[model samples]
Target: MSIKEQVRQLWKTCFDDDDAFIDLYFRLRYTDKINKVIEEDGKVISALQMIPYPMTFCGQTVATSYISGACTHPDYRARGAMRRLLQETHRAMFAEGVMFATLIPAEEWLKGYYARSGYATCFHYGLVKKVINSYEQPVDNSVSCLNMSKIDLLKTPQERIYPYFYEQMNRRPCCVQHTPDDFHVVLSDLALSKGDVWIVDKNGVMSGLVFCLMDGNTLSVKEILLSDEADFAEVLRQLAASYRAERLECIVPRADEMHELGMARLIDVASCLKVFSAVYRGEGLYIRVTGDEAIPQNNGYYTVLPGKVSRDMQEGQTYVTFTISELTAFILHDLHPYMSLMLN
Candidate 1:
């Protein structure tokens, strides 16, 4: 069998996803170039994919590699195969100019496992539950609301929605920006799970967009974006009524009252500091980073000035020292960083 087949078998053994979902993943998301694996006796033993993504950080788009489908064969567990694989992947990503590496841990225990590799728990989201009550204005069918599934994704004029999606996503101060291809994969995954995208228009002007999936009687929103004048309460009522869902749960970005969704590791420290300095222009500071063993190049003293960052130590310049994790948090603090529609 080929490497893809070997990795597929390993994924099957490690994850409990249904065959259809697995098939959809391999078909739409997997690629040989992105796959990294370790093999013994010419058979794959452990694997993961470094899927490339763009993220808006400090007012600029930066390259990021999202670790996905990470798994190791049961027999290979505790053998250091995954640890070694991740170290190598980090080095490769750093060399390839990746600014950060991000991933959603598959299990709670895995958070500690990843933290050991320089990842900091940063991505967060809050859940909102709503039940439509009587006396609210009914959904205006005349307002041109459309429900989109995978088939609609194929049939609808992408021109109609993609520009809006792109604009809304990039509006976030710190968030992952999905390319058109990634958006396709997201919509495809949603469709595989019988999800839909609702686009609402007011006075023939696009206003609200919601991506949601149904489970039994509940409709869970993955992400929702709206214009300033859009009424989310109206949208929620319409979604609940349309799906006959007694419960509506929506994922929203919040600084507190949120659950951890993912972690991120700063790969190229100088570039990250540059972005930070650019965003917080006119701020001058010195930082010394330590405890970055995976990417030792990041361990050093740095100077941050208006729109510039450099690795240099100045005489009598006070510097705040930080571990890799601490540095990640300090830079991302108050940014309200968020990532969604990731098929997590």
Candidate 2:
């Protein structure tokens, strides 16, 4: 079998995703260039895809890679296959100019497992849940909704919606920005799940958008972006009425409440430091990073000056020290970084 097919078998052996979702994933998201695998005797034992994404960071956009569908065969477990695979992937990412790597652990315990590879829990999200009551349904005459699916892309054209989507996503100071192609894949997955992308139009302008999926009577809003003019309660009421959903669950960006969602590892420390320093120009610090065994180039002493970053070569200076994980978290601490439309 080819590598994709072999990896498909491995995915089947490892994950419990239904066939339809698997088919959709391989068709839309999988690519040979992104795939990294560990083979034993011509059979793929472990694999992952380093899918490229754009992230708004520290006032500029930077390249990031999201590790997707990472899996190892059952027989290959506890053999260091995944460790080697991730290390090799990181080297390739560094060479490709990817500034960071991100992933959502499959299980709670895997969080600790990935930390060994230099990942820190930096991404978080807020959740809002509401049980739709009959009285809550509002007839808001000033606002209208436009619903679309994958097939609607051909009818309405993706270019029209993409500009709005791009604008809204990049508005966040730190968040994953999906490419036009990635947006199509997101819609494809939503369509497969019999979901809809609701465009909230107020006074003939696009005010908000909600990506939602339904399971029985509950509607899960994967991501919702709305401006100050839009009312959250009214939006939920309209959605509940449209889908006839009894309960609504929406994933919002970090505000009053937060939940841990994903992690990130700094691939190029100097590049990130420069960006961070540029944004937080008044903050200065000297620090040593030591625990990045996978990417030893990141282990060093660095001085962050006003709007610049340089290696601190002085031997006897007292400076703070951090592991790779600690450095990643510290850099992202105040950013409240978020990721959505990721099919996580």
Candidate 3:
């Protein structure tokens, strides 16, 4: 069977929703930039969806691709379909000039599978924030706050806002790669209908802004950028009141000191730690990665490697090296988990 037919059959068996299956199938199949792979017998049983990392991650401009919709049917699980697909995908991505890839892992066991494929953990962070029902008035010395929803990105003041925003966040240790285009993409997605951008104004100037999305009952905050802790807290208050959301959440980098202080008010650290610890089991393994671009957090720290892999204090263990694209797959759980099973 052809690659398209094989993907369709696999989706039919793995997912119950016809609409969702079709949507995902076309997304992977028609994304002209992506490559597809299929495993079959008399009929298609498994499939892998991938695109050149360089193209996906703005690589010609940035360096990685976002991988999603990777699956194998039950009848084909033990046959190594996932592993073969990932191996092939990695090879293709590497040759195409992609330096990295990323995805959200589906299961905990999948973490170990990517390790054997030469991928390592990079960084782990969670969405968390306190919800407030009301905002307090600014005291004589309190910092001023402004809702970005009230401002227009096309206006002169709004245009000036982001340059300062980038300056404040770029200095952070775990910040991700972003550009003006990236900011617009995120804002456009969040502003589906309801306004999603909010700026914290201090003394008549833009001090910081919160970028987020509303999915039913939840407000998913991608980032909260501010010059100080007090301003960050106040922004949260204004956001909750303005959106009328019951809860607020933001995905913060683990190395952020501000996150540590805000964790107490935002999330239950013990629960989050348990989840992270369980997902990451490869500790003490040293792996070197070579790529055109570098993921800053993963470059120096043993604990911050994207996936669950850690440094083994033992006298002997296998040391491995991976490409940036492969490492990005490991962190995002795009590769097969069984491949990393041996590493744990």
At residue 85, candidate 2 shows an lDDT of 97
The prediction achieving the highest lDDT against the true structure is 2
- Residue ranges of candidate 3 with Cα displaced over 4 Å: 1-30, 39-45, 51-62, 126-128, 131-147, 150-195, 199-207, 214-219, 227-230, 255-344
Question: Which is better, 1 or 3, measured by TM-score?
Answer: 1
lDDT of 1 at 259: 89
In model 3, the worst 10-residue window by lDDT is: 335-344
Residue 90 in model 3: lDDT: 62
User: What is the TM-score ranking, best to worst?
Assistant: 2, 1, 3
Residue-wise lDDT of candidate 3 within 1-344, one digit each (tens)? 65665666666677565564365346433353464565465665655555322211111123444455667888778877777776666656555545444444555675567544444554355446666444343332233434444455334344555686667655543234445644544444344334456666766766677766676655667676776633565566666656666677766654233221100000111222223344445444455544423222233213323244343333454546645435444433431111100000
Per-residue lDDT for 25 in model 1?
88
Using lDDT, rank the candidates from best to worst: 2, 1, 3
Candidate 3 matches the true fold with a TM-score of 0.55
Off by more than 4 A, model 1: 134-151, 281-283
Of candidates 3 and 2, the better by TM-score? 2
Candidate 2 residue spans exceeding 4 A from truth:
135-155
The Cα error of candidate 2 at residue 130, in Å, is 1.7
The local lDDT score (0 to 100) that residue 156 gets in candidate 1 is 69
